[model samples]
Structure formats: C-alpha cells, structure tokens
Target: MASVEKVGNIEPMPKIYPIGGGKGGVGKSFVAASLGALLARHGRTVALIDLDLGASNLHTFLGMPAPKDGLNRFLNKHAQTLDSTAAPTPVTNLFLISSSTCSMEIANLFYAQKIKLINAIKKLPFDYVLIDLGAGTNFNTLDFFLTSNKGVFVCTPEPTSIENTFRFIKAVYLRKIKQLIKRHDFDAQAKAAVLDTASNALTSRDIMDIVATYDPEKERFFKACIGRFQFKLILNQFRKNADAGLGKKIETVCNRHFYSPFEFLGGVAFDERVIDSIYAKKLYVKNYPATASTMELEQIAELLANGQPASSLLQPAL
Candidate 1:
C-alpha cells in the first residue's frame, strides 16, 4: 500500500479522466475500479474517486469497506481536502476516495461548494485521477463529468441506456458551449437568449446563425472548441456477435447528430466472473486474472494509457 506522502507530487498537473454514463447499473463503478487497478498494476499511482456522492460504491467494488471519511465530509467542511478523506485500499499504487453516505443535502450542494470540491480533487497527488461520476445529468454530475481532461461515457447495448447516454453527452457538450459563450463577455440576458435558442436542439448551422449576428470570431472559436473536446464510448455487457455493432452505431449517432465523433474505446463481454467477483467483494482483474473479461479490460486500459487508436480493436464480434 502506497501512502499519500510516498506518492510524490504530480508535477505539470496529471491528467484527470472521468468515467460517466447517463443511467445507473451499467457497470460504471466496476469499470472505474478495474481500470484503476490495471493502471496501478503498471506502477502508476492512481486515485479512484467515487463522485457519485449519494450512491458511491467504488470502494465496495474494490472489496473494501466504506471509509469513515468521504466527499461529503469534505464538502461539509468536516475535512480540509479530498486527500484528507483518501483511504488506502488493498491494491498497490492505488488510493480510494469513497463517496459519503446518501444525503439529501449532498444533492443540494451550492455552486461554491461544488467548486471547492473540484479544486480539492485537482490538488490530490496521483499520476491519474479517475472519477467515477454519479449517474444522471444533474448539475453535480454534469459539472464534474465535464471538468476532466478526458471523459469516458459507458453504456450497455440496451436501448434506454443508449438513449440516455446520448442525452448525457449532448448535455455536457451544450453546457460547455454555453459556458464558453458566457465567458466571452456575453451578459446574463444575452447568454440566456443564446442558450434558449440552443436549448431547442439547435444545429451547428443554427449556432452559426446566432453567433454570426453577434461575433463571428467567437462563433469560429466555439466551433473549434466543439471539435477539440474529447469523448470516448465504451459498450459493456456485450454477449452476442451482433451486440458489437452497437458501439459503431453509437459512434455514428454521436457524429451525425451531435457533430462530434466519439472514439469507440472498446467493449466488455458479459462475464459471470465479473458478477461473482463483485459479490465476493473482489476485483475481477485480481481475482480472475485469466478470464476473458480481464483480458478485455487490460486492452481498454492500454488504449486509455497510450492514447492508441481503438479502431483496430473494434472488430466484429465472434
């Protein structure tokens, strides 16, 4: 177990990656733990944060009991920084930040409180900060989801989950666009006017129309920002040959509708050992090392670490 002190400072600001899905029970927590574990196995210090404030279970997935301190304590000023709530898990080179117990108040954290929490997350010492965001598109989840250097959206082959995942992605994109516009000297009334139009499911052309009327340079900048934002998709619980096509379909949908091409990261087939390990309070990567699921997880981890193109791995299912 590596202590926080032993983990030297992450100079130059480590990259933060957030894993989020629009709906719950799609194995977001499981992916977070497995990826963190794999990264740790490679000698990189990893911090797994359960940002699902009310329903965090990353600790459970890692086979550890919930910590006495968590994000809630930090938010309520019961702890100074998120590092103060960090607990050493059984995995080497990995640290855990559990979510506080369910709290109605957590759902109502003010904007200032949320900013404080994010700043604390940035200050944590680690090479990689993987945030397992809470499910849904509420202000809390969306804010943290978009704050990372990269965002991974996990969804299964189910229709409802895919639709909600699309919604979540669109919401984040629109929110970022709105923020950029406001930051460009657009006052509250003007900003609300632009957002109202964009809220009606406006197209890129529509955005150009509104922005061209005000500042064409800002519009160009907005388009460039949209192009630069990074989003990756992972299809989980795949079981059949046809199930693999769902990933490309999602990518196509995102590119066609949202004007943003999504990198189809990879897929994980349905493996019984994943569930068995969860029930046993152990990570499959450690407990079922040779399983197919573990192999696929390793491939995904490599893709994330090296920024390798996943197109080669996106083969048709057998």
Candidate 2:
C-alpha cells in the first residue's frame, strides 16, 4: 500500500466525480468500485469514498476488512482528516474511505455537518475522487452529487428505476436553480414578478431565461453551471439487446425534459459471476475479468475516462 505522499505531487487538482442512483439495488457501488479500480490500474491515484453513509458496503465490495474508523469519526472531529480513515484496498493505486458505522439515518447529518463533510472531500489528495452516493434524492445526497465536477447516474432497465432516475435528475436541476435564485435574493416579490412575465411554470428553462433577461451579467455563469452539470446514465442488469435500448430512451426523455444532454454510459449484462463474486466478498473485475459483465464495466471505465460517447461503444456493429 502506497502512502498518500507516495502519490507524487498530486496530478493537477483531480476532477471530482460522484456516482449516484435515485433508487437502491441499481448497482451504484459496484460500478463505482470497478471504475475506480480501472482508473487506478491506468496509473491514476483514485480515492473511492463510500458516501452511502448508513448502508455503506463499498468496503465489502473492495474486499477490505471493515474499518475501525470512517467518515463518522471525521465528521465528529474524532479523526483529523479524511485521509486518516482511508484504507488500502487490494487494487493498486486505489484507496477506500469507509463510511461511519453509525445508523443509516439521513437526518442524522445537520447542515454544518454536511458542509464539513463536503469540505473534507474537496481536500482529499487523489487524482480522481469517486463518491458512491447513497440512494435517494434527499437534500444531503443531491447536494453532494451537485458538488462534484461530474455526476454519473446509474439505473437498471426496469420501469421503476427509470422513473425514479428521472425524478432524481429533475430534483437536482430544480435544486440548482433554487440555489442560484436564493444567491441573488430573488425573494417572493421578485419571483412573482418573474413568474408574471413567463407563461410556463418555474422550470429550468424559464429560470435561465429570466436570469438572462434581468440578470444579464449572470447569464454566462448560469450557462457555465448547466454546462458543468455533466450526467452519465448506465443501464445495468440487462438481459438482452432490447433491454439496452432503455438507456437511450432515458437519455431522450432527460434531454427533452431537462434540456441537458446526458451521456449514455454502457450497460452491464446480467451475469451470475457478479453474484458469485459478491458472495465471495471480491471485486468482480479482479475475480472474473474475462466475464461479459466485467468487460462491460471496463468499457464503462474507458468511456468515462476518455469522454467517449456511449452510443459509439454500445451500438451493434454493422
């Protein structure tokens, strides 16, 4: 295990990447671990943070023994920094920051605690800090997800997962707009004035238009905000080619509704090896690299790292 100092001069303020899925049982942590391992294998120092808080299982997925310390300790100032809780995993260049052993209560975190945790994550020394966000659209999860430079949303082909994923995406955008509005002290009076001028309800597009019209100077800032809000969608547990199309469908819906172009990350097929690897408490990539599921995950890592379009790799070859 290499010490954090051994990472050599920290590669230019690594990009913050957050992995989140609206609903549970969507394989968010599994994909996060695989992506981190792949990045580390390519010589990038990666910090995999299990932000799942209450139900954190990233340590088990990475094959690391349960930690004696974690985020909870740091949040309480019992630990000095996030690095203190960082544990070395079996994968080279990959480290795990386990979640606190505390109960899985989302409301357990106060506003100050939330800000402190986010600040600590921003200070971690790594080339890529991948946060495995807990399931749901609660303020805590949404705030952390938005704080990252890139946000990846994972979903299965099932309708329930897709519906919840849409809700999550919409909630994030709406929250962002509200934050921006509050920053300018756009109180009830100002909001009423803006609403009277617009025909539609308070949507992201309407917010942008209002900002551009009245707050012209901040238009560029809002545009940059929308541009920086990158999203990548993945369809997991796919059983057939038809199932893969679900990703594109979701992407279209997101683009139409949110006015955001969501990248379609590749899908993972239903593989029994994944289940077996989990049962054995091992990473699927290291345990069964040759399996179809593992290969698909590798492709996802490659696409994300290179910023390649999902359709180019996911489409059937003519």
Query: Would you estimate the TM-scores of all the predictions?
Result: 0.85, 0.83
C-alpha lDDT (0 to 100) for residue 198 of candidate 1: 41
Clashing pairs in model 2, backbone N/Cα/C closer than 3 A: 54-104
Q: Rate the local accuracy (lDDT) of all candidates.
A: 0.77, 0.76
Error of 2 at 93 (Å): 1.2
Backbone clash tally (model 2): 1
Tens digits of per-residue lDDT, candidate 1, 1-318, equal 112112234432556889998999898998999999998887998999888876777887898888777677777778876787778889998899887563756767788877777766767778888999878888788878866637899988888888889778867876666667655665444466677854777644555567777666566677776776578888888777646577887787777766555788888888888888888988778998866777788778878888873464445245
- On the 0 to 100 scale, the lDDT of residue 14 in model 1 is 55
Error of 2 at 256 (Å): 3.6
Separately for all candidates shown, the number of backbone clashes (residues 3 or more apart, or on different chains) is: 0, 1
Q: What residue runs in model 1 are displaced by over 4 Å at the alpha carbon?
A: 1-12, 101-104, 187-190, 195-209, 309-318
